[model samples]
Target chain A: MSGRAIVVTSGKGGVGKTTATANIGLGLASQGKKVVLIDGDIGLRNLDLILGVENRVVYNIVDVVSGRCQPRQALVKDKRISSLFLMPASQIDEKDAINTDQMRDLSAQLKEEFDFVLIDCPAGIEQGFRNTVAAADEAIVVTTPDVSPVRDADRVIGLLQSSLGEPQLIINRMSMDMVKRGDMLDQQDVLDILAVRLLGIVPEDEAVVIAGNKGAPVVLNGGSPSGDAYGRIARRILGEDVPIPELNGHNSLAKRLGRILFGR
Target chain B: MTLTELIQRIQHSFGKGGSKDEAKSRLLLVLQDDRLGLTAEEKEALRQDILEAIRKHLKIDAEGFTMEFVSSPTDQNKMHVSAPVQVGRGPANFSK
Candidate 1:
């Protein structure tokens, strides 16, 4: 089969789209698959920072589209992974710098050379969102388990189904402790409202924030729970039957025993 | 006090309940007929059809059941219909 193009997007900002894209790309590349991640956010690009290859970007997507450089020249290879590459977005250019046709052509060309092409889409349902999703074979809509993010994600999913097909859902930054306390929305509530197939659930972890600051994706750390979740998501994307990890955090056993012994 | 006045005074004695009683249940209903590309008349007809279908199938006991016509995200040729019924108990024990 040919390579697949996947777009990681969230309707609202600050829902961890860039982080998920970086981690999933790294996880897939670690499994011996050639992967290329395109930061489609244009002027607000941050995927390079998350991937730890910001200093190596000489050319970007604009250069490739404008014929100033070849696609390979714009692709910055990750030092930690042998088969991973990143096509950084232009920080100075705007969203209209590249049209949908150019993005489609670029994605098609990249698909010819890599096993997977993941596009990090910008937030909001605008031209940038359209351009990035225009070339994707599948789309993953990321949302936190809060009301605002979940509502925005529902709108995004509706748009995707109307424009494309049904996109997969990814619940990011979940907290099991909050769920246990009835202070946070659970995955079931999100699924009930979105009514889409869930791709994965990533728990909120402090290590993810630290990894972001250090310009390293959490999936590379391996010991972090969120990192392991992203690894499982990558395997699932490759059609592996990976089981969803327990999101009960470290208090699952204690909570269960308390419920059994105390009936609370 | 008169008998009727006595009942009213007793009813007023029960003040508003605690935090649990203060918590209200909300149902989010989305109407999507526009996305399906249906004309206004067709949408209205679909809405009427949905209400008629629901009324024909089940007996609505409470005053909270709402029926609406929604647009279909996938195909413009279709319309989505939704109905939200707020019964007294949780839906999991509806059979009882």
Candidate 2:
């Protein structure tokens, strides 16, 4: 089966790129689709730890590219979901250990066996980013509401537009209370600036931190708001037209007043 | 705060519209410049050079000349340089 390869990336670090990758990978797998997660951040691998399969990572992408192990052998299967798998990155190798052509070949090989191949790209516009971007057929850019992350996301979006058409956006760590208080940038504000299609908006749920700490994706348990948001994202990925509910509750007077007062 | 600063704040939001607005405005300018890849001064210089070069071969209405770097209506990341000129002379030679 010819599956779709998508890269999850953020130009800035600590903007939830890896976490989004793990959760979305799990979300797609839980829906009975064959999903494989590849940790593209070679030197600093985190997807394995986030997926709670760090100990089971006997081989990594470096070994596969170097011909020490085959691609299928490097895949670490998830205990919870039999369909979910991860190709962990090498902790000892640098980002330049693998080139773009090799990445493209490996991604093509993996796509033959999986329905969705999600590559967790590293931060920055360096070689690591190029390698991951070369492997993907589409892209998903993750960004927070903060200025720095949003600016970097814009840059990454421009690059992806030149390569992979238009990449979808995921606004993470969005705090509804702050948006109501006019203290934070809302989803609309971000969309206005980024001007891309929104895949999902994950709220600032404390459960995300707890899930990361526990080495399990938030979508696996299915109780938290973030999990529900990811489930909707997965449905959207599967061509389901699920409407995203606004967190600010239908644009109250605070938002209108703020808009008029600020002349925004 | 100074009187001018306080008045600006009052005119904007009465101290209620917080840093989010500031961030949005700043990001807008930065992204526009980043996508355009040229400053106002640089674009003016390039336009003048192009107009001079065009005037050497054909007669054109320099007053009605327009050049713009616009984002594509369909694609946000793509940019198009539109320089529509009104030619005044040489309709026969231009056809060749």
Q: Candidate 2, residue A245: CA error in Å?
A: 1.0
lDDT of 1: 0.79
Provide C-alpha RMSD values for all models, in order. Answer: 10.2, 6.2
Regions of candidate 1 where Cα sits further than 4 Å from its true position? A246-264, B1-27, B30-96
Question: After best superposition, candidate 2 residue B12: deviation in angstroms?
Answer: 12
Docking class of 2: incorrect
Per-model DockQ against the true two-chain complex: 0.05, 0.21
lDDT score, candidate 2, position A225: 91
The whole-model lDDT of each prediction reads: 0.79, 0.86
Pull out the clashing pairs in model 1.
Answer: B32-B70, B32-B71, B33-B70, B33-B71
